[model samples]
Target: MLDINNILIFFSIYMNKTCKKLISCYNIFFTEQGVRHEFR
Candidate 1:
């Protein structure tokens, strides 16, 4: 039972890390697009 809980915790942490990276990438993309749109 303890081993199962440890595995779950590891998976959750890995997911959270990936989500943060994706959000950062999206933010950079949108910021660039917004600037171009405003100029046009």
Candidate 2:
């Protein structure tokens, strides 16, 4: 059970990083268009 918890935590962190990267790329694309949008 402890190992499973650790795996879940790792997956969550990995997903968070991937999501942040995607959002950053999206923000760059939107900024190029001169429109302001936020994610939070």
Write candidate 1's Cα lDDT for 1-40 as tens digits. 9999999999999999999999999999999999999999
Which of the numbered candidates is closest to the native, going by highest lDDT? 1
lDDT of each: 0.98, 0.89
lDDT of 2 by residue, 1-40 (tens): 9999999999999999999999999999978666544432
lDDT of 2 at 4: 100
Question: For candidate 1, what is the lDDT?
Answer: 0.98
Residue 38 local lDDT, model 1: 100
Q: What is the TM-score of each predicted model, taking all chains together?
A: 0.85, 0.80
TM-score of 1: 0.85
Off by over 4 Å in 1: none
Q: Candidate 2: which stretches are off by over 4 Å? A: 35-40
